[model samples]
Target: MTIIRNIFHGFLRAMSSNSKIPIAPVGVRGMRDLDRTKFSLNVILPVLKVREEKLSKISNILKQYFLKLENFKPVQAQDAVTKCVYFNPEKITQWNEFSEKDKSIFQEHNIDHTSFSLQSVQLSYDNFKIDTIFKAVLPENEETVSGFSQIGHIIHLNLREHLHEYRHLIGQVLLDKIKTCKTVVNKSNIIDNTYRNFKMEVVAGTEDYFVTVKENRCNFQFDFSKVYWNPRLGKEHERILSFLNPNDVLFDVFCGVGPFAVPAARRKCTVFANDLNPDSFKWLNHNAKHNKVNMNIFRSYNLDGKDFICDIFQKFVSNICDGTEKLKEGAKIHVTMNLPAMAVEFLKHFNGLLRNKENTVHVEIIAYVYCFAIGDDPASVAKKMVSDNIGRDISTSILDVFNVRNVSPKKEMMRATIRLNDVIFNELQEPPTKKVCV
Candidate 1:
């Protein structure tokens, strides 16, 4: 047994050093020597040296076995330290011979255990091998278990080599069924094209709103119409709306599909939503109708090109202030924009918007920085954009940047809030040097 333990340990150590098996034994467990002839010839080996490298192989094999399974990607490997069941010839035979009826009986009883010879053995595989077996049991409610039984052999193989694969398969099977059983409620009929040429679904009794189908972009939803703006200025909308009193004026620069405007209108706040995209402008008007709110939609473009600071200032003066008439004296304007990476660049233009205003207007300029996670530190990509674009104009002291929730897994989208004091400004300078009222 001691010799066998050393041999097993050595084999495992060598394999761990050479391969990328995710599972590794931390401490020595009891080991025993069994007849070398007892090993089954049908055992399939994992070809890949690393766990991630084997993903494609596993996907291909699973696809081959289950034709309906598409886009099968591995997420996380299950821990299999104490879960592995070593088997002798008799136990293997019993598993192989398990009838559909027998499998159903075991499932009906929710049995998760298997009786087999207990021994710790080290397994080795070639790095070039790509595919490994995965196994799962059929549900007890399954009428015809042949489909499951056919895959049982593969499952058994995975169980012997990588118990994590077996566990993953089981979870996948259950999740698939649950997902399939879900009833997709039809909200497509509620789509109204009277205001905009788009599809909208209002999940009844919830503030959640969804917009359908954008080119190179998936359908998106927001929590509130006022703050939960989508595409860019979602978080800013939420913050401004949180503090907005009823009937307050909200201005959204480059507002897409009324994420900020619609919610503000729903809250009975006057909203002026503007966007450069013709489609977005159309959708904004349509979303207002869908939500049964009166939101002013404006089609305006920031001609500033890459110089967002100059562009934003010009847009505010030419379009938002003059064209929309929403930036009136004493009117509190909650300005929302989905360009966090470029928000600071646009701050220098804020002085011009507040200039000549009698009543102190609140300007909430939102800069959404797409991050990997909700609370993760801003990645280099976003920080670089801020530094490259807005570094010279303003320091961090004058800017109010709040992290919004994570919008994507790639950290490509995040929302940051910038609240500006609505102090009256008399002139717009190349460098903004206007006093702001807190």
Candidate 2:
């Protein structure tokens, strides 16, 4: 019985060894990591040699059927020939196809097929596009990783649970494919924390978090793990800055690394930027200095949103109203509350703060409050939230309901620009009676 058991065990071990996952065969051009998880493909295309001077004419004639592979040069030197043009494999499978199916094309173009040698060229994994490589390697019917936000040298991915198993493989592929990406991170946790910075793990490439990003012709460097930076907000930032004129005042309640404040300061706008995150505050100052923003026009603070509004914001407006803070002619006060998740809740503090001083303040006050909502009418939903928090129906004061970006399939990041008119600041006082001409 013992001898029979040993024989069975040995047989089982042999079967297991034979059933081990197979590593993919080596690629033609020495592609790396061609294994069961990472794979490669080989493609062949038709090629023909021509003189360098005729390259432009031939390319123009066959531009529709020319190889469209990105980062690929269809024209190359072939021995004594100065130029060789490759055609799409799908259009011309073999040299005979050009003579048979595509014979009319040559006849129409008045080309001599016998003058040029018809040859087939092979392409390796190195020649394939990033998307093609991903589609070839990833499992069938699986959701491939496509969208990503590039901040500086880091690629941020909010991958779903289904991609968890292939996280490393996906990271490796991205690091290899993207030339500017030095680090790839996956954020698994929700961004509901106090500082709004999500915890992320470095899936591939270097572990460095410090990176410098350029936006709106300004440089900003910060620690990625300690602060929040979204590259997709570039257009929204530009849109907000468009409303500001020289000598305008900006009060950024949730400024992160001075995306709005620094650029506004450079544009000669007096900026008072604040954020609860200490790292963000530190980088805001750094970026301001780096971008050579006028120090006289830029100020940063690390304070709670409510405290900043109560102390800093209230005092600034009070100074403006009391004539203590001098302003240039046509200067306006623009408040930017960019904390989308909970910025609407802070709108209540602005309600009565501007009361009784509306007449004293000469310039207009516009509040750009950002919020996230999910519905068919997300802009209206956001407007209602702002109106409910401020305790006023600001339908007439609504300047613009801009859809900043789509946060999800149904959720949107909406910006409601509300002018601080008599409805909000004056607290519904009687309208001034019109004077009849004597």
Candidate 3:
């Protein structure tokens, strides 16, 4: 009886071992995790050695059918033979369909493909799965893929702890696949809890840290590894700028590299931008010039938002209302505290922030505070927290609440646009004003 039981168990183990496994989930929509196969029909057209300069002129002919697989590289310095790869091996008919314009471009540039060689070559790809051109250098388990930051010409990956071993391969793949990415790096320790910068390891490509990028018709250039910059806030910055007019004043208490300030300045709104990071201060000044914003109207400061509000921000408001009464207040002055982690606490400064202590000023001061909250209802959680910190009953005066993005499984980042009540300006008489926000 024991021998029969043992034989049955062995049979069950064999069956389990032979069972087919399920396919792994594709974590991100754009990620390619499969292997790429070599196709024999891949096009390989080598331009004539003498007329290589004409390659660019005729390349558009190829782009009509195939994606560019490889950039031009010197085949031989002596013969001046250069070659570029067109990704399409399947579009051979397009080559025959070439127009006279293409031939004329070839004729004008003296390019000919007479000595071209066509052959099958296995395109080297790191992924083991089929049909994937570029595979992420995944962890040993291949499950978690974190988001990355593209700074200028660099792509910075904040990989999980398990992905360190494959960092180099991943960096190399990114450099090869991302035409604009000259350098790929793995960021360790993340943005410092206090300093807000990361330790970077360059896994592949150039080591240059300086980068240039454009957002909302504004150009920004900065050090990718040293400074803090988030492309995700491009729209948020624009949204705030859209609310302000040319004659208004903007106080970007935590402005990093003028992402918010430069555009506001361009809109003709005088801007007083400040940051705790010196790099951000320098770059903010640089971007102000880079964007051709009027320097006369823009100010950059290296200070914590808490101090900045007390000094530069106060001076800005004082100068704005130096002659004019505080009648048109809320519509004219705007304060943006964007450090989501600390912005809510910064609201305490507004408890007794402004002077003039009137029941209703000409216009009220509008504060846009960004915060991160974790709960089933992030808006209510953040709204309550904002109310408690500022000492005002949020039963009224919370103008607009925006859910920025989901940072994690349960945590969300949000923005609350609140009109400063008279109660916030030194606990004065709370009087009702126009409900409409300009």
Candidate 4:
């Protein structure tokens, strides 16, 4: 009985052993794990070559890697190619390894040898091929590839690591490049040596508002206290200010961070700045005080309402003129709303403000639209104010689409200019004695 039981036990052990699947080796498992989480050195090395054949090899490797990984989606590959490494294929020779020949070629091409760090090398006996990869470290806190600030340059490289780990470093490199290359041609030189150079007062929690460089003995001032204010819009503010007349009553709607309003007021124009953001309103007041600009600024959130124009006009009439005065009686008002996209919708509303029998008012609404050519017609963007306010159609023809800047490799933001004719309301049959600005 004991012999029979031993035989049965042996048979059961054999079946169990046969049923069990073969476990993957540690090296294979490690490679799989690495493949799932990180970019492979094998894939990156070919991209460094910058040749048609090398590019093809890189694409194939990427495809194989994507297939091998359970979850690997290529969000942007072509764009990545343009950004990742800076090398001219025509001048630089293709190198399979960091051999004497490769070093000599690099020297010939003036490629910085110190920047390249060889991370790994693998040999394939079956194919008689060698794989060598290296990483290039950008300058500390620099935001560009190859130390060039061109908008979409790759500054850093990671072999077998997540792309996001080096994104900020890459972005910093790009930003640094932009700052280095950016040249503001001061035609009028308003900010040149003449104006009293004062150290900008540092407001707590507003570091982005001003840039103080002690090396240059210059402090760049930006109106940070108002709505929609960005240091990037400094040129726009200067442009508007340059065109302003001293006695012109400049009205700025959506006056973010007071970029337009502050500059206009500084130019000695009677400026009325209005914004929907409360924080911006506070900043606008603070900036006005900071810049020492004498101006009337209002903070209101309901600028999208249908009755907003009339309400604002009433207040302007009472404050600027006497209480009983009306617009279109004899008022020459230069209306300026930098929110160009929504300016068209406000035209009808502006007409309503000037309709009352108070005074004859001439209103000029400068509409700005940002856009680019789609095919033959330009692709434009404008906020339909009437659609936003009363759910009405305000689809008017685009006057002129002006290209502002390239936002991406294929896309751009442009500004369009539209004009509204002399609008007189039926209620203003008899002009009032006092002229009220709309």
Candidate 5:
């Protein structure tokens, strides 16, 4: 009998060391009815009956050991007649575990240190967190789906093929856990190159696509289905904006809904924003107007990227040379090409387009070109591609090469900043001296 008692105490000690509170009930895999799927966790906790008014004071004194079970109060009615404050079982199982300081505090407060009684508390499904639910339902070896992009009221997920069967469950869990989420969608296909927007299927919640997002101190409103926007690029946008000053000139060649152009205009910089997609162009004008930047400050165009580049630069050069447009002293010119798939192909247009020895002597032009490259070193590969496309060695003129983001395990999205000065633009040859009369 004594041996059996010792073995039982040993088992209790092991359980006390390894047991976790609020554990989910088993056999709920592939279950879709979230509320009806009940889970219960029964734990033997230490309970102390106290007067109703001392509940708050005792709770504060024992805050570190206060019960953390969700949707249940730590202080509750013990029976039809009394109230008690419960302590987390994982923290203490006996009266001797309390420190001398805690004992003295309890004595000073007229509370008996030996008054704790072991009581069984039952926690239900509402007690578990989202990660606990996912772990309880997902296979032991399977990957958990937790990463998502939240844009306004929508949550965007890129679930793997293995998670397809659990898509609805995953979306429902996200919607239920995230307070601000009103809709959840998954990418149904790859992004279309021309429009840069992907087809998505609503997995849960309302199917509203029109939303407004705030970034870089600017508000942008657009239909998620008609335009392309990545919240991950917010830091990248701010990094580029940090390079510009007020009254500078910015040319956003492939501006999608004027993410860069609108902010630049707000900075007091003159902006020329263009896009090929009609929806993007319309929204660009709308966003500029909504931001209170007039057409005079932020120009909009729907021309192709190449055509826009050529037309804008030529007009700019002509304006500078002929004095039709005046630039503020020390103002710089910036060109942003953000179509990562094929922006390098458009670099040749600026080879000789802005070369004017007399007019552009004091002008400084900077070009930020984004592209995708696959190699061990994607930044070097991107720089080499930019040099090859422009028909010159831009190694020295290249100011910065940044890894904007990774598109895949092997492919990377990179940005190369190139200085376009007299060296980059072909210098015009001097006409032969005429000496016919002499």
Candidate 6:
């Protein structure tokens, strides 16, 4: 009838001191299914003066027949000369069945031991997924739960229409299950294409709008209620940004909250960032200053992507021609169009981009255009779409095409990286015929 109150802390023989993996306690609650019959009956071992080398041998033997709870420290009286160690033995009454060699070690030191009354506890490795939890709590037909997006501290749920009533329960469960999330919101409206923001109702936690997102070694602060921020594209931004060098030029069209422009500027690349959404522009400026990007190198613009390209391209070409804008040899020049829905169609604006200029800009002008396409092979479809929209033959223009992610079962987001200089600046090529969509 012993109640074990002692906990022990030390690395076991198998554990390393510098392991990065997070260690869970013997029992942790994670909304998991539990079996009532299975539990550990702890055995409290009396402290003994044993050789330092024998600790491993004694621990190994204890682990053979009981649960070896590692990394637990004992709480004892301040003046106590020694502390007790604990183990959870499955068969509490079988302590006398040990071999004679093991019995000598325990009996020789007179280390008294007692068994603890069994207590229910959760296992660390249990099936605690949201799908299972939802299915258990929700009705079968109404359990149409669409997945959620982890945006900053918020769990953004765009649940299927049928699951609206359970949004609060779902949000609370998500908040409880996740360690980092503080707030949860259900999307009230679909994403607004023009502004890229969405209406949301707070289902759990505080009514908060301000959130800071860290990505690509940069921190960005934005009003989540007013601007758009997606945590999923952090890797994609870093991937393309690795191609840039100091003194390179980046024109980020539809640069929502400066995900691309701010990090590029941090790399010492000159950035001209633009977005039609006023909130995005304001946050872009704010984030650039907050991140300590050189204002001389980073400039924010509020204009449509079409206007940003047509007007800014002319100005950059003008500066390149007049020798006002200086760049290092082989410095890359990039035009980033990130509005996946319309960015590909925006390529037509670049057809006659540098044609009429007398500027001999010796820089590689590259276009990183994103789009959404539906097909089995969305990458190929995106490449052909870019070729047709930019009015260039696909054979000579494609530098690379990436299947970004699946938006849905049929729809996919893609990025087509093309060197616009090869096709646009070619004298034999005709000016692009399609109108710009952005």
* Best of the candidates, lDDT: 5
Tell me the lDDT of candidate 6. 0.71
In angstroms, give how far residue 62 of model 4 lies from its true place: 43
Candidate 4 weakest lDDT stretch, 10 residues: 125-134
Q: What's the lDDT for all of these models?
A: 0.37, 0.78, 0.67, 0.38, 0.80, 0.71
C-alpha TM-scores of all predictions: 0.37, 0.84, 0.67, 0.42, 0.80, 0.71
For residues 126-160, could you state the per-residue lDDT of candidate 5 as single tens digits? 77777878787766688877578998899999988
TM-score of 3: 0.67
lDDT tens readout by residue for model 4, 5-118: 575465345434543211111122112112211322221112232323344434533243221111222222334333123221222222333457545655554543443321
Which lDDT tens digits does candidate 6 get at residues 370-400? Answer: 9998988887788889878877675466788
- Best model per TM-score: 2
> Across residues 1-438, which tens digit of lDDT does each residue of candidate 1 receive?
898667556545544455422322222212122122222222212211113433353343223222111232223233432222222221222232345665455445343235211233233221101112111122223221122211101111112222222333333332233322211111223213322222322211222233232211122232222221233343445565676666455556656565556666667666555665455655566656655564343323422323333454334534443446444444454556554434445544554444554433234333332222223455434444443443332224235344564444545454434334421143223665789999
Candidate 4 local accuracy as lDDT?
A: 0.38
Put down candidate 2 lDDT per residue, 154-196, tens digits, no spaces: 9999888867767787787788778999999999898999888
Worst 10-residue stretch by lDDT in candidate 6? 6-15
Candidate 3, 79-171: lDDT as tens digits:
445554433333332222346776666667655455232332232332122213223324334645456778778888887766676667667
* Rank list by TM-score: 2, 5, 6, 3, 4, 1
Model 4: number of backbone collisions: 32
Clashing pairs in 2: none
RMSD in order of candidates: 18.5, 10.0, 13.1, 18.6, 5.6, 9.9
Cα error of candidate 5 at position 315, Å: 2.1
Rank candidates by lDDT, best first: 5, 2, 6, 3, 4, 1
